[model samples]
Target: MTKPIQGFSKLTKEEKIDWIVSNYTHDAESAKIILKRYWNDDEALQNLHDEFIENTITNYYLPLGIAPNFLINGKLYAIPMAIEESSVVAAAGKAAKFWLDRGGFKTTILGTEKIGQVHFMFSGDADKLKSFINSVETKLRSEASDITKNMEKRGGGISKIELRDKTADLDNYYQLHCTFETLDAMGANFINSCLERFAKTFKQEALHFSEFDETEKNIEIVMSILSNYVPNCLVRAEVSCPIDELADNDTDANEFAKKMIQAIEIAKAEPHRAVTHNKGIMNGIDAVILATGNDFRAVEAGAHAYAAKDGKYTSLTDASIENGIFKFWIEIPLAVGTVGGLTSLHPLVKLALEILQKPSAQELMQIVAVAGLAQNFAAVRSLVTTGIQEGHMKMHLLNILNQLGANETEKATLTEHFKKNSATHSAVVEAFENLRKGI
Candidate 1:
């Protein structure tokens, strides 16, 4: 049995790798080679990556691809996507090209308010607690002035604070729900700093409040943190064109519109379908979020929470036919930043944002929303007509070929063959064997 080692993090990078591989890997030398293979050639760049997180390890890489011809708000953008999944970038490009002449995508920023909260246990009377919070709101804001100063100069800071009583749910449970406007940034660290300060000030002041009894004065703060459920930080992206314009060589426009609407409706009503449907939307959103060096996990959390905001998980997108026009749109809460975190640090992230023209936070939000909508359009379009596997499997063919040990020449030939045939795993294996045997 393997035993845990002490001070593992204190070891040098090489020592750490040696310990890990010697203890766990069957072939330690091969494992060491694999780990070291991904390190950057530039020493400075490799050092920068090593400092990104604790217990440094070799960098893991993903393909950074561009989905071109995304026209949003009268401007054309070639969205950079960092993802390993096959067909994602291609599908996005296909959707963008399809909508290029049809008034591409239009987006609107509905709101940009973010949330933070201080959870506490109050054994005092509810009415008194409410009055105390109301009177102490200004003090809470003032105490965080240092943290919010720079943000305020940029026209964003604390928006509001509210006292929420939840004694019924859990005994003596309550929350100091706060809101903020963080312009041009994701605002997680900012919001969290403000919240921690608020928690400190609120607790310190409670001990001296004249209206509070001994029990009320001892307000116990549970935690102070930013919430990843910014329903108010929302953006909408939509595409609309004449119904007949949606027609392609293989599908009728009216029938296509009907089927698309039906597919969306089914997703809206069924959680199973909605989960997969929303995943496709995130496939686009996450790729852009990752490329731009924002927090995709937080954006994902906020989006999924918003989808189930009405008490049922449903589709993040909707479609309809009105006035002889087919419209498809998505309204999602995306809290992303173009100026912080990895945005300025990572080389690829910098390139990705530059490719996007250094958009503001709101502009980034719109672009991400458009990417998601376009991706959904492509996925649903495939689902309702040619079926998803046809395109998905074709894109997945090369992955299978690589796994089956096919060389470049065989890959090229097999790729051509699969273009005219289904690329199922078993079928590819049979064909690969035949190709090697000169069949």
Candidate 2:
């Protein structure tokens, strides 16, 4: 059994590594080597990575790829994607190239209102609490002024503060639901700061208000935090072309459209399919979010919540054929910031945003939405035509080769062999064994 160590974080990096490996693992030296092997050569760069989070370990790596020829609005963009998945970037790029001449993608920002909340409880009169909140609204704003001033100057700040009674949900539950307009930033810190200040002001004002009796004055504030469910903070991306232009691989356009629509409809109605379907969309969304240094966790939460906003989880995408034109689109609540957070700090994040032509928050939202739509299109197109595994497995071939411990010469031979044959794990393994036996 391993004993706990105190102040582990205070130790030097090597000492920390030694403590962990010696205490936890049998092969301490090898484990230590693995951790240190990933460190950057440049000391300054390594220091930058160390400060990103606590408990400095070696930097973890993911491939940063580009999906080129993404024409949105009128200009072209080469979207940077950071992901470990094999086929996502390839599929997105393929979809982008497919739609390159067909007017590319068109996007519209439906709204940009982020949200946060202050949860509290009061065992006193509900009517009195409501009236007290109504009268104290100005005070809430005034108290949070210092936090919101800079944001307001930037044309982004608190949009509204409402008193919501939820006595039925839990004992004396209430909320100060606040809405915000954070123009060019993700606004998590901005929103939360305002909420905390508002919370402090809320309790202070309640205690001093003349109308508030003893019980009402003791308003207990549970917590103040930003919400990730920004249904109103939405963007839409779509692609449309003549129905006759939808043909592929000598397949009829109408039939192809019909099959794609069915696939989407099935996803829209079934949870099992919808989960994977939406995951495919996130494969694109998360990659861009990672590359641009936005919070993928918050985006994922908001998006999934929005998908089920209508009472049941469904597809985030839609497809249709109308007026001899085939159309596909996706509307997602994407709360991303082009400034602040990791966007300016991380070197790769800055490069990724620059490569994207330095879009505003709204433009970034549109670009992300387009990438998701394009990815889903590629997935559906493959699903309804050639099947998903055909392309996915091909992209996954290298991973399998690496896993099987194949040398460069053997991997090359196997790669060529799999191009003409199936790439299933068992099949590849069997083929490798047979090839070794001169078969």
Report residue 105 deviation for candidate 1 (angstroms).
Answer: 0.2
TM-score of each: 0.99, 0.98
The lDDT of model 2 is 0.92
Candidate 1 Cα deviation (angstroms), residue 76: 0.4
Clash list (residue pairs), candidate 2: none
Candidate 1, TM-score vs. the true structure?
0.99
In model 1, where is the ten-residue run with the lowest total lDDT?
335-344
lDDT of 1 by residue, 1-439 (tens): 8898999999999999999999999999999999999999999999999999999879999999999999999999999999999999999999999999998999999999999999999988888998898889999988899999999999999999999888889999999999999998899999999999999999999999999999789999999999999999999999999999998888999999999999999999999999999999999999999999999999898999999999999999999899999999999998988877888899999999899999999999999999999999999999999999999999999999999999999999999999999888899999999999999
Best by lDDT: 1
Clashing pairs in 1: none
